[model samples]
Target chain A: MDKENRHHLWLTVPALLSIGLLFSAYGLFGWTSFYRATPGGLGVGGDFTFDNYLRIFGSWRELAVIGETLWISFALTMISLVIAVPMALVIARSPSRLVRSILLFTLAVTFLSGGVTRAYAWMVLLGNKGLINLALVHLGVIERPIRLVFNWLGVSISLVHFLLPFTVFTLVGAVKNLPLSVEEAARNLGATRMTTFFRVTLPLLSSGLVVAASLTYSLALSSFLFPLLLGGGRVRMVANHIYERLFVAYDIPFAAATSAVFLVLSFVVILGFAGLERLVRKVVVR
Target chain B: MNRRSLERPYGRLVPLTATLACLFLLLPVVFVVAFSFNDGAYFQWPPRGPTLRWYVNFFESERFMTATEHSLKVALIVTPACLVVGLPTAVAIARGRFAGRDLIATLLLSPLIVPGVVTGVALLALFTAVHGDLGLGRLLIGMFVFGLPFAVRTMVADLLGLDPRLEEAARNLGATRLRTFFLVTLPQLKSSMLAGAVFVFVEAIDNFSISVFLTDERSAVLPVVAYQYIRDFDDPTVAAMATLLIALSCALVFAIERLIGFERMMHINRK
Candidate 1:
């Protein structure tokens, strides 16, 4: 036991170093957010103030961004929940191994592919001159190209696809635990297929949906690449807002202040979801 | 495999939903790959004609190649470093009874919870102040923070599933703890290590949100370069580069599927 304990501490050195590095950086970020941004200056030592925080709250533009971030995250999670159920049922309940593996393979590829590649692919697929529009025009679905890219609709579409793999994987286990007998029983009782799914499967899936929602919400909240590549400065989430503020305007303090707020906001929202998920599980179980 | 799956059949709707989901997943990847081969100098819906010129151009360009090199250098360095730091922590989490193990695990895994850009913003601020303008070294530290959690999570899951009796058996035979780990335990961890290595390597190379803020021209990774390319030019060179990544990621999915079973591999991230 003593030897084992020694090995344990020895093993944590690298983790300790990692934490030490990150926290010190985080400490610096928080510390820097307080300093007054000297005009015509790179970082300079000066008296600390709440000016950075005040400035973010002071501006309607920044508050709008924060609101947009929350709205988008919520919408993304709701959309994911709608889609994760059917996909999870397929993955967890498919009779053919080939079909299951193929679906899983598609998901793995989506999950494993680089963010930049995925983002670029969306750009090509959704851009004004891109495939979807071109195909639509050729088929006489529309004369002029629809506004698909550079908006919430395009961002939501890409991000929902981006998020499906994780959300499905989260809910798959729950689907597996559900007995086929229950659905079969409902079908035998003269319930239609759609009725069986809605009345039988979905309520049972409530807890799983909530759990997956928490995961989806968190992933959506951190979404950066899709919004950055596809949003075209129209729908700036908090991360991009911070990026633009820092790089475009060279406002380091404000960026830090925004990040600090984002961090707190994410924690509160995720914690709320966690609490909700637990309550859901308890209610579902009872 | 679930034996029930052998007996149970999904109706038409499930399969239909799943197919559409696959198409939605595959279309972006397909478009990117297809456009890379387009002979047009501009963005054309259909290829003007098929050609290998863009792929050739990507390799010949010093700018893209150097960014690829920097990406490779960062991933190669960060993967092993993640292993060194994360392996011990994973072992502790998997087997140790030490105080503060939970806290350390949470600290390492915090990157999953916190927005990755927070790390980028924080590290950029801190590193800029301390080093002013250093390049890869600063980026390395940033990558380490993000990479450690994944590295730790993979090993922890693998280690938990490992039978603890093997190490005890080695110890009973008078092998030292280090000897047991190197000779018996480490060998068993080979699969997890391989999976983790591939996962971390790809993650480091592809990661942008954190790395973006930390990189200067000298330290920019492939994604940053690709991002810049698309922003500046309407050319298809970035598509070629993206195709290469798509192919590599496809190969990785298949590789993990063959070696570790793709679902098990994904479970690491799910955890």
Candidate 2:
């Protein structure tokens, strides 16, 4: 063999090993979803069956959980877009490095502070006598502490926070790609700034918006902690359901089945958005 | 009249909204830091007094310390493992003109797309099915699996972003492909590699959904232990530990920004 060929062969080993191990790991995970769980509730024992798949999909409870998960994910994505698009616009349009860095720093802290810590922080903020409640009471906004925890409201708040930085990062790329001159020309043509933003800039930003929403949606859909901790066991995200099936219910086959379905569903949703993004690019970005 | 109406609303509104949004985004971390030093035992609003009691308790407690050590050990080991296994894949993708490249890239990065909870449950099932006990080895491998995508993504970005002419120039001067890669390409990847390593390390420490299933009583990482502690005790010790982690992460982010520039770090997160 030639020297270059040998080097290519050798260099390819680690990459190949990584690909093999990853595929096998996921493959095994996918493979085991087919078998029936052991009666002992320890592991899979019986022959392959579609019963596990049937159970997860057939039950209304499981179906609602899936629906709720998708709803929360969509809500999280939209909220993140509302909050992040403006900030990302500011970041992209600002000529000052200081402003960009400060914004970026806030995003980094939010993005990197880990979900558990973020959840705890939200707990402090949203607890019955938590800061927000206390402040609201002091301000006479409410007569009593509201039930923020153990509900959809709490889940949405935390997930929005968790997903914000990602949305911002995605949007920043999109906004940066937009030419400043386009907005200027629009304004010079007698369009109002807001109109220019809504008509020209936003249409141009459709691709980035889709990318950000898709990312945030997927993250929220698969979210475990916000629902587990902040949702206070009352909220039922698919992730929490999957966790219960595996650890609480000791139903391995059901858990695996749920996971396989979850994987497929997430791919479908993400790819759907990617397709939407392509469509938007074709129609609007031109 | 037109300029005043046009400029005043947004000029005032944009920064105000942005500031408020940033504050809302940052409030949670600020609260974690503030409450960690609270004199009271439980996590409650309005501190009794500023005190380091929780920090002392966190450091002095053997269980918490051990969990912290476990977290550090896992991150330390997993970062290097990711680099070794992921770099070649990144190099191959960047340099090779092979078919199915995009497919291969997607497969390598699949872990990032899959939910952590699902990955955790799936891996736990696989481990138990193949081997009875979920050991530290299995946990390490699992984490390495999770970290591989980030490492490869970062390295691939770094490699692709660089001018190819430098490596090509070295090769034309008679340096072997291996030597050129090691001397020319590897050195250039140092900053991004450091950033990637830090990212993976933090990920290993921060990972809970996957680790929770894989971790036994004797092998819990800090986040899992903190979670259990929160479940059992309402003390500020977990808050204290969290504050410490936040500090460490901030420091790492600062270092990464210094090493590779902050914009580049943010760009690496795109994948």
Question: For residues B1-119, could you state the per-residue lDDT of candidate 2 as single tens digits?
Answer: 25554343234566777888999988989988999988997656556889999999999988888888888889889999899877887887776665666777777777788899887
Once fitted onto the true fold, the runs of candidate 2 whose alpha carbons sit more than 4 angstroms away are A1-10, B1-11, B43-46, B132-134, B267-271
Best by TM-score: 2
DockQ score for model 1: 0.55
Candidate achieving the largest DockQ:
1
Which docking band does candidate 2 fall into? medium
- Candidate 2: fraction of native contacts reproduced: 0.48
Instruction: Write candidate 1's Cα lDDT for A47-81 as tens digits.
Output: 87898899888989888999899998898888887
lDDT of 2 by residue, A1-286 (tens): 2343335445556666756865676778777778877766556767877888898879988888888788778877888898887898778776678988889888887777787899887877898878888889989999999988778898888888888887898788778778766776777788876788799888988988998898888888888977888877788899899888877878877887888888898999988999999999999856
lDDT of 2 at A205: 87
Q: Which regions of candidate 1 deviate over 4 angstroms?
A: A179-196, B1-8, B163-191, B266-270
What pairs collide in candidate 1? none
Provide the overall lDDT of each model, using Cα atoms, as 2-decimal numbers. 0.83, 0.81
Each candidate's interface RMSD (Å, one decimal) is 3.1, 3.0
Clashes of each: 0, 0
Model 2 iRMS: 3.0
